[model samples]
Target: MKKLLLLSISLIISGCASFGEGVTTAFLNKQKEKDLRECRVDGKSFGGMQGNYDGSNNLLKVLMVHGVGTHIPGYSTQFQEKLAAELGLDEMSSHYKEIKLVNKEYPDQDLGVLRVRRLLDQEQDEEMLFYELTWSSITNPQKEKLAYDTSGEYSFRRAEVNQMLKVFSNDTSPDPMIYLGKHSQDVILASFRTAFCWMMGRDWDALPNESQELCTVGQTAVEHLPDEDFAIISHSLGSRIVMDGMKSMASRVSKAQEGEPTSTEAAFITDFQKKRTPFYLMSNQLPLLDEAAIAEKNSASLKFKV
Candidate 1:
């Protein structure tokens, strides 16, 4: 019964067409609350990005990371549009830039893609570059193992609602499992790293458009680290990735700072820490996804009246 309730909730959230509109509306109306959810922010307060763009000298850059489930490069389109409107960014570049995230050592691996859009005010003075990272491709191959179970050959045997639940399950259930794998975790983090590198490396004009090339930090990329501001917007499991990725980078930066090295990598890592980039996480599950014990389940038996 609990599992069925969870599946029903998922169906409602997914806006499955088969769900009765009247029932969906009632459920959503109940959820559209009188401010019942408590939000507690545990960090230093920061300013908004309204006027952060200061001509050519300073640039406001925002990177977005998605959560569990399959996502395409343009998944953040609606959000971006709304954000732009709020910021009074009435104009944008004719074409957005796209870069394929790749690691030099793992050339054959399809890490993911980064889509970048440049937004500007009517005066073309205030500007922001929004980067959307789509890393689902990295885990899609592993999820293909469940393909047969979701196929019509098997799905036809189940009830309609059950089949829908199974399809949704097959789509999202494997992500955290796949992320738990050592190799896949490393690869996903690598994808995030690549996206960060690209965000740091270039401006709108300097960025590569539609390419599967890897980004290198280089001397020049590190030089601009101080002039740029970065923020991350992430949802659900993506919040975990962002947290883990930042911790990993911060650890490296801390080590490099201790050594006081002069290499490009060392310089970049040290400066990257100075940015103090903020993360605005939505539907975050970081508390639930403890890296050390994510797979551990409570051994105690539940006492339920059957």
Candidate 2:
């Protein structure tokens, strides 16, 4: 289930070079929210705080993308702490901040939930921002559990597992890889959408209540700190997800550049490319994914404008 799914998604993404076309394919051919923006729709906290932070771009910003399996808030913080320690940085605890995508556990039947534990340390020309991204909430096995009045309680428990599969039949069981297999396109997209939202630096705690597809909303906020290097750290199966996300982002930039006067998407991606966003594939599937991960490029079938 996992291997097949990965191959399908990878080919669609790494194979495409146009944003307008790649996103649809990158999503495994899903088209529910193609027009959605990565940032907030409102202007209040629009550009995130990036609009004000005129800091140097010498910082090493990491967008840590996690692989499959069940994980929680602590997962993000621990990652940042360990990395800081490896870098010989002290006072790790003081630099941690626990944040949720919607500021609540089991965030109101959302497809995927993201919580970033931002670790910030800056010293003039040297700075480091580790934004640990976790998408386990939507990729867990507990989602298969259906609620059926345990202890005859109705107004005493919280709501959960309403994403992906809305109805739980009597004879059906939830597949573990539903996150990667069919019936999970939205779940995967939610992860991509949320990551973009955070990268764009939106006030996610202020996410609107009626917003079902908040992942599809848009705001041209700073996806990354200006002049800073953006590198992704992927682990386990998360490597494929990172590849898909970056490819989609790159294709989107290409499409945006085709606009009458270019686009914010183009500008945003171009900046990151200029920064040479590095992919640290720390996943365990490096051996298994090497061949399939080989990016395919079509160069000879192109024409130049005169």
Candidate 3:
């Protein structure tokens, strides 16, 4: 009798659009507006993922990693708004000049300004930096479509990829490329070539190997910035990227510090104290893998609500 009653309730709940729906449209719309306001006030592009430095004497940095097939600008923008609100940096604005967009494809891109919300002492200036790692193949629509098609799930993947790209671009401009659904490896490679051409000032043929390519991009950005207190935030597939990147970083730092007395890497390590670098995974569906391995890997920090 109890099981039958539960089944009846489930049927009624499933028929409604409200039950089990994650992040309502109304809420998303409001979040969009709030994100724009934060971006404008901070003088940062909504989609900027990596390396935003607020002008100040004190130094802190943040790296935001996006899941597979997502870019920096769109993904970073949403999270930045949330972080700003949480840090109480909403109203403060410094006189520092904003970074300009040099890439024509991404006209809205900018180096973000950090607004200090709290200070441990009045004599100190607090600074923050934001960095992003956007996969090459996912940056361009043509490439994403091709990857989706090559994966043998073109229709579903294309729609998902396009929607994500639109969100990242934050451009309402109509895209005619929406209809070309049949993707191929060649197509994906070509799309990546275009985006990388703009970013690295080189042709698609000159691109580096997959592992080296992503690691170089991420590490280069990290190296260029002021090595100060830093935190990492990754979502969805980004969690995987961040894990890999951090592993690479740890290895590099360890090797470089061989037989040397230094605390540089230590500072970076301390900054990522569990409380500071909190990893939040939303709507995560693990890829084909054993449940035991997943549990073993993330047992310490994993929190499963459902």
Candidate 4:
């Protein structure tokens, strides 16, 4: 009897363990499927080549911009490819290329090369949209060490992207470029200009002087967008740059409205007060501007910290 009882207990324990393992495996499989679904491509290629253009059938254009420490062909490539597929443009290839470092422009100054592609259909008369996406590396050495052990850094990146997207989707205007960040401002600007030229089918030199200017960079790039609505995704310090540019642009417009054609500098100040442009900032812990100035000029701006 004792032996039989022991045998029964062993059998029960083994059955429970088997069941637990099976449940765990099933859960893991589901997670894998979810990840794959997020990354899966769904559209057909536009051209015989590996590039995507706004084919005659497509109506909307989306431009993606990358943030600091990221460039074309990096993780931004994957995200753009996935986004294109999701938007039913699987045939369309990514429009932006990575920035390459050629040589130092001067001592301590790095000159970078930027490559950008246009993922639009030339035959289509679609409205263009911009999507800017960026990520930041923790600056604090101690924080960086802690970030590795905890997935906080990666989680923040994903959260920032999602939050930006939510605001983009809410916008009533047409979609525009999505900007991501990587280190090197010149590279970022170069890539942006290249992408704009490709999308517009215009020469690089034909771009407006205002568009090429550092302070007017974002506005200049977005102004080239075929659509009126624009979405910006900026992280860390990149957010400051975007905000400052917007404020400057707003100041310019305001100045122009006031009939003050004083100078480019004066126009920027005028525009800042006249325009009610919509902007969304994500995970921005640092204050980029005078809090009082921003509050006065851009009271309508939405900020999300994650």
Candidate with maximal lDDT: 1
Query: Worst 10-residue stretch by lDDT in candidate 1?
Result: 292-301
Q: Report the lDDT tens digits of candidate 3 across residue range 31-121.
A: 7674443433455444232232342324444544444443433345556556665554453223211211123333343211211122122
From the highest TM-score down, the ranking of the candidates is: 1, 2, 4, 3
TM-score of 4: 0.39
In candidate 2, stretches whose alpha carbon ends up further than 4 angstroms from where it belongs are: 1-56, 93-111, 118-125, 141-176, 200-226, 259-263, 286-306
Candidate 3 matches the true fold with a TM-score of 0.36
* Pairs of residues at least 3 apart in sequence or in different chains that clash in candidate 3: 47-73, 47-74, 48-73, 50-130, 50-131, 50-132, 51-130, 51-131, 52-130, 67-238
lDDT of 1 by residue, 1-306 (tens): 999999999888877655577788988998887877889979866556654654354468899999999999899999999999998889988888988888985789999989999998888777889999999999999888899998889988999999989988998878887887778888899889888888885788888778887677788888888778888999999998998888877786788778867788776776776677778889987766785344433323435476
Query: Against the hidden true structure, what lDDT does model 3 obtain?
Result: 0.39
Q: 180, model 1: CA deviation in Å?
A: 1.3
Better structure of 1 and 4 per lDDT: 1
Per-residue alpha-carbon lDDT of model 2 for 126-245, expressed as tens digits?
345556666666644455354443223542353455322333321123322343453354455446646655555343233332233444323345343344455677787677777766
Q: For each candidate, what is the lDDT?
A: 0.83, 0.52, 0.39, 0.40
Ordered by lDDT, highest first, the candidates read: 1, 2, 4, 3
Which candidate has the highest TM-score of all?
A: 1
Each candidate: how many clashes? 0, 7, 10, 57
What TM-score goes with each of the models? 0.79, 0.51, 0.36, 0.39
Superior by TM-score: candidate 3 or candidate 4: 4
